[model samples]
Target: MAVTRPLLDLVNVTAGYGQTPVLFDVDMSVAEGEIACLLGRNGVGKTTLLRSIIGLNALTSGNIYFNDADITKAPTYKRARKGIAYIPQGREIIPYLTVLDNLKMGFSASGKKAKRIPAEIYDFFPMLKEHLQRQGGLLSGGQQQQLAIARGLMCNPKIILLDEPTEGIQPSIVQEIEDTLRRINIEKGITIIVVEQKIEFARKLAQQFFIMEKGAIVEKGKTDKLADSLLHRYLAV
Candidate 1:
């Protein structure tokens, strides 16, 4: 069954860096517990759309609603507190911080209640529990990616925005990440909006997808309806 209410909604949103526009009147939405993907080629403004939702990229014009409440102008911190989490590209794990401290940083960054790593986090990434004292910089790209995601889960977000979760990741870890994401959505009912360019990856995870072209959503539909022919048409640029 489809969710009766939207967990995240972006209506005709225009946003970008100062004096420069990247996303132009983009319209998108994700239902409660739904897994959606923003699909596009490079420089199509998909990342900008995700950043705009988290308040990292300021909106010049538009209204954003979370749980049906307007929050277009809310600060990033406030948005984080409201159960929205973002794990941008490049992983961005602090090189020197211990794995344990990095996990705590997620809770701290959101101002979420919970000083210690939740037991569920260990369940999500058992390796993190093993390397609690290991420095983040020393872990492999896959392990760091796992840590980055685990950090987001520590915040207990209702929805998570992941930009290219599998980019540069090894195939084995990519599969693990895919299974973990499905588990998160099915087991916890958390909504997931992942920005990805890989067809094989996105097709497996997203129930629906929005295809971006030249800064706008040119096509969208249920994952079952998306075809390789469409990919070659709108997303092959």
Candidate 2:
């Protein structure tokens, strides 16, 4: 179900913390409506790549194009407004806020006139609908992850960047998350770039894949063409 045209493109992107580079000349593209997975062992710059796309990490050298516009120099909030939603690692929903409020907070990034949470949001996460008044901190890890994804959708993003979504969840919820992500892509036409460590999950969820090592992309292709040898070389601990 991947679209042919690229929705997000990163060309020769090098980014990092102050005076220390983490991503090196990384070039990648996510086709419109495609689910692309970024895979690497710990400390291989997978998270940094996602951060770069969301504008949280500045590029030392490169160009990022989204919807055919250069946004490499844009600020984080501006990137969100430009329809890039980032769900960072740890499912960082405001702990004290009610679930409903957390979702409402997404409006700050969207700048949409409609202030009401769309009914479709609840349709996607009926569990959240049932717990609208509950505090975000009270949800289980899997539920919190769902809330994080749901909050991102409130902005009606064209693309969603997810970091380590399956890190701490149980197997059942992991399957649910995977199924939900696929449904989101097919039903909502949202492009997804997920930073993931689980090989099976990545293989099942992504149509395209990129594997990184020591801050640079070493391999990439359609997921169907991903060879086990590559995983053994780059992903083996």
Candidate 3:
């Protein structure tokens, strides 16, 4: 099948922290309303690529485009304002803040005055409703992860970049997260680019898969056609 015009594109991107380059000439795209996964072993530059796309890490070379607009140099706030939400690897919710407050913090970059949580966000993660007043740090790992995602949804983002939503979480919660992601894609039409180390998790959710090795794309194809040998080579257990 022909690939659609990408909602977000990274063309020949090379980025890193300070003097060391981590991502090398990375090129990837997330199509509108599709769940695309970046799969790789640890230290393969998966997080760096996500950071580059979100403007968290400076790119030494190349360009990034979102909704066809060049955002290579856009500040982190600028990217957030432009409907890109990032959920980093650690589910970095503000431990001291209430769950409600954590979600509100995500709207800080919205650049508009808005009151109340978006009903749709709560509809997707209903567990958050009961814990609105609870401290973010007090929630279980699963709950915190849900809050992290709900916080992203509060931004009303066009695309969400998820980094390892299944890591360090219980199997039941992982399934819950997978279901929620599918609903976000099918019902809300949000484009999702997920970076996951777990092959099964990515395989279950992604329409297309890209495997990274030593900071470069080593293989890519529709998820259905992913070769077992390639998985073993790039993501062996």
RMSD of each: 2.4, 2.7, 2.3
Instruction: Report residue 75 deviation for candidate 2 (angstroms).
Output: 0.9
Q: Taking the tens digit of each residue's C-alpha lDDT, what string does model 1 give over 94-117?
A: 979999988888987678565778
Tell me the tens digit of each residue's lDDT in model 3 across 1-237. 854558998899998889988889988887889899999999999999998888899999999999878999999989999999999999999999999999899878677666888888889999999999999999999889999999898878899999999889999999999999999989989999999877888888999999999999989989989889998888896
Query: Per-prediction TM-score, please?
Result: 0.95, 0.96, 0.96
Off by over 4 Å in 1: 1-5
Best by lDDT: 2
Q: Per-residue lDDT of 1-237 in model 2, one digit per residue for the tens?
A: 754337899999999999998989999988889999999999999888989898888899999999888999999988999999999999899999999999998888888754889998888888999999999999999999999999999899999999999998999999999999999999999999999999899999999999999999999999999999998999883
lDDT of each: 0.89, 0.92, 0.90
Backbone clashes, each candidate:
0, 0, 0
| Candidate 2 colliding pairs | none
* Weakest ten-residue segment in model 2 by summed lDDT: 1-10
> Clash pairs of candidate 3?
none
